[model samples]
Each structure stands twice: as structure tokens, then as C-alpha cells.
Target: MGSYIGKTPTELEMAGNEDEEDALGFKLTVLRDAMIHLRVQFLHFQSFYEKEGLENIGNDLKAMKIILMVVQNKIEELKSIIPEYLEIKNIGMVKQKIEDFDLVVTEIVLEMKEFERDNFLMEKVEKLINKLNPFDVPNLETLDQELSPNEMMKTIMSKSAKKQQDKMNKETIQNDVT
Candidate 1:
């Protein structure tokens, strides 16, 4: 055979190993960067949630203030009514004013109930945000050491299957009850 001036088989094998390691390192870097981006997005969502909740509260407060003024005006009108001069017309006017006051009060009560429901929903969203906090994610080193991509995929698939099974079970139970 002609004299080879190139790397030997051992050197070539080592070079292949180095390339593999470099590729793995690059992939790890990319993963780290992606995680950082995800964290930033989570933070943005949290800020938006808080801002939106505050604005909703402010609007609700303004609505309440307006309702309060309406109720106050109705009260003043009732106070001005002279019971000593009770006539058919005055009595009818008083009844009309009372009905209007009742309607306003009913509307305020309904709005309060709606506000309470919205608060409950916001609380649920807050809990979800807490659960999805990116800072709670396992460190990259620990994650890499503990689970390979295949293992992670298996875990996710198993969880999904369990959830689907649970949903089917619930449906069956409901059907039997019905």
C-alpha cells in the first residue's frame, strides 16, 4: 500500500468522537437559550395578567361608584316626599320612584355577583400561573442527568394516556348514573 500521510484510524475515530461531543454541546446551548426565552415569555404573561386584573378592578370600582350615586339620588328624592300631603298623584309618584330604586339595587346586586365570579376566575388564573412558573423548572444539568429525551417523551405520553383514561372513566360513570 502507498504511504499514508493522513491521520490513522485511531485519530480518525477520536476526531469523530470530538465532532459528536461538539454537536451535543451545541444542542445543549440551544436548549438553554430556548429555556431563557420561555422564561421571559412567562414573565410577560404574568405581568399582563396582573395589569389586566387591576384594570378590571378599576372599571368595576367606577361602575360601583356610579351605582352608588344613583342610589343616593333616589334616597334624596324619597326624603323630599312629604308624607303629610299624601294624595293619589304623590302616592303614585312615590311608588314609581321606589320601583326605580329597586331596579337600580337589583342591577347593582347582579353586577356584584358577576364581579365575584370574575374574581374567582382570576384566582384560578393566578394559581395556573404559579404552577407554570418557569423558575420552577428543573435545572438543565439535573434534567440532563435524570432523563434522556426518550425517557421524557415516555413520561409525557404516559401522563397523557392517564388523563384520557380518567376522562373516559368519568364519562362512563356519568352515563351509568344517568
Candidate 2:
């Protein structure tokens, strides 16, 4: 993964000049990215274990599922706080929302840390935990800064297309060899 270069929500909050909404938006975006990354990592690890015929990964997979659900729920909660129309319903609630968001994120981090410590899939889990760490939010922020939402969507679609093309090319090569 490329190094991320941008301000974290904590840094933005500490700076005290950034708009509260923007800071919260940045945080939500980071959390969304983290959730996506975590889900992808979990799926990768699960598939690896299954392919290796590792039967002991069931418990770990369950734990990962729970974590993903929690993250998805939190992301939904954060999204609901900011209205779709961009009109601030309760300006006073922004600070409270930030604090609440931070608390949930801290809880999730602790859970991930404990899971990482106890799980057999240590290396992969550790990577996921590190990515989800609050201090590492800047890594995601860099990507956000580099791409607008539409551009990011397009990039993702293009990458998916490229991967599919590569898979077809590999299949063709294998068939030729056969």
C-alpha cells in the first residue's frame, strides 16, 4: 500500500481552525475506508485458510465477522449524524458526535487488539488492526485528498476491470498450454 499523507481528525481538531463538520466528515471517511479495508482483509484471510484446508479458522472467522458488523453499524451511525442535504440540524451536537465517534472507535481498536493477540491468524489480523488504528487514519486521508468521490469510484471500477481482464488472460494462457 502507498503511504498516506494528510491530517488526521485529531490533528484537525487540535488545529482548531478546521470546520467541525469537515473534521467529522474526514473521520467518517477514514472509518469507511478502514471498514472496507478490514472486510477485504478478513475475506482474504478466510479464503486463504479455506484453501489451505485449515479447519481451525472457524472461530477466528466468526470473530472477524462480528468486528465487521460492528464497524458497519458504526459507519451507519456516523452517516446518520450528518444529514444528506448538508444542512446542519444541530450544530451543538457536532462536538458530542465527535466524542461519541472517538469512543466507539477506541472500543473497536481495543477489541481488535485483543482479537489479534488471541487469534492464530496473527500476522493478517495485526495488519488489519494497524490499519484501523486511529493514529493511522492519515494513511486513508491521503487517498481521500487525492481523489474526489466520483474519481475514486471510477478508479475502483477500472481496477476491478483490469483484474478481471488479467484473470481472463491467465485462463487463456492456461488453456493454450493445455
Candidate 3:
């Protein structure tokens, strides 16, 4: 079992800008946590599949389903950030979406790959990811920047728009039953 938790994530490129560095640190922090979460999830599923036989690993499959749903919601939230992605133009919504997607994707993609046989889906995801420009996503450092009043207000809209906090809480458990 290889570990996904590698050296601490750092924006080695941002050594030039202190402000950028700070924001990058926050982003990387979020990425790190998400990575760890996904790693644990994958490990759990792998074990479950092995023990129960992949054909009967319903519990493990359900867990993946849950993660996918949450991650999809998160992607929707982050998509709000880049106008290039979708119809929503609200900066807050976009930031929230980005954060949400970041949270889920960092954790699940590597693990999910074990189950996926499709190359097209991976291509689309890669495209969307490449389109992202980090500046559009907000962080505490971004809010701290001094700016014109109008600029501040436009930015204010994004202050509260992340999407992960909107996930559905499923109390019902999935059990194999006829």
C-alpha cells in the first residue's frame, strides 16, 4: 500500500511574493488535508473490496458514491469562481466551489482511478483543472489587500461562497438487503 501523503505541499514558485506565498500556503493546507482524507478513504475501500470480494463490496461502493456526490457539489461550487466554467458569475460562489472541488478531488481522484476504466472523463477533469488560475480564488490574504471601495465590494461577494459546507448529511445507512 503506497502512501499518498508526501512531502508538505508548497508553492516553491511563490518565493517571490509574500502575499502570494501566504495565500498559496492556505490553498496547499486545504489540499494536504483533502489528500489525506482521500488516502484513508481509498485504503478503506481497497481493504473492503479484498475481504468481501469486489462483487459484494457494497459498503465500500456506497462510500465512494457519497464522496463522488460531495465532490460533484464541491466542483459546482468552485466552478462559480472561474467564469469560463459555467453560467454563474458570483465570485463568492466560485470560490466556494473551488474550495469544495479542491477538498474532494485532492482526496478521491488518485484512489478513484483504481475503479475507473475511462480515459475521456479524466481528460475533461484535467482540462477544467488546467483552466483554473489561482488568483480568482479568494483567501484571507486576498481579503487583506487594500483596494478601492468598489473592488472591495465585488470581492466581498466571494467572502462567503464556498460549496463544501452545503453537502447533504446522510443519516441513512446502506446495507445489503433483499
lDDT of each: 0.44, 0.52, 0.46
Candidate 3 lDDT, 1-178, residue by residue in tens: 2333553346432332454445444553454344344445555766766587657776776776575555455455334424432322343443553654565455345535545553223333333343333344445444445556875554455424423222321111112111
Which scores greater on TM-score, model 1 or model 3?
3
- RMSD in angstroms, candidate 3? 15.3
> Which has the better lDDT: candidate 1, or candidate 2?
2
Q: Rank the candidates by TM-score, best first.
A: 2, 3, 1
What lDDT tens digits, residue by residue, belong to model 1 across residues 1-178?
3443597998776676555544433443443344344334435544655678545455444544454444445444443542432422223333333343344344334544565566334333333233333232233243335455764554445445755864786487457546
- Candidate 2: tens digits of C-alpha lDDT, residues 1-64: 2223587877765455335546665656666575666656666655766676555666656666
Q: Model 3 segments beyond 4 Å from truth?
A: 1-36, 82-178
Model 2 clashing residue pairs (backbone): none
Off by over 4 Å in 2: 1-19, 84-178
> How does model 2 score by TM-score?
0.34
- Tell me the TM-score of each prediction against the true structure: 0.31, 0.34, 0.33
Model 3 TM-score, all chains together: 0.33
The most accurate candidate by lDDT is 2
Pick out the ten consecutive residues of candidate 3 with the lowest summed lDDT.
Answer: 169-178
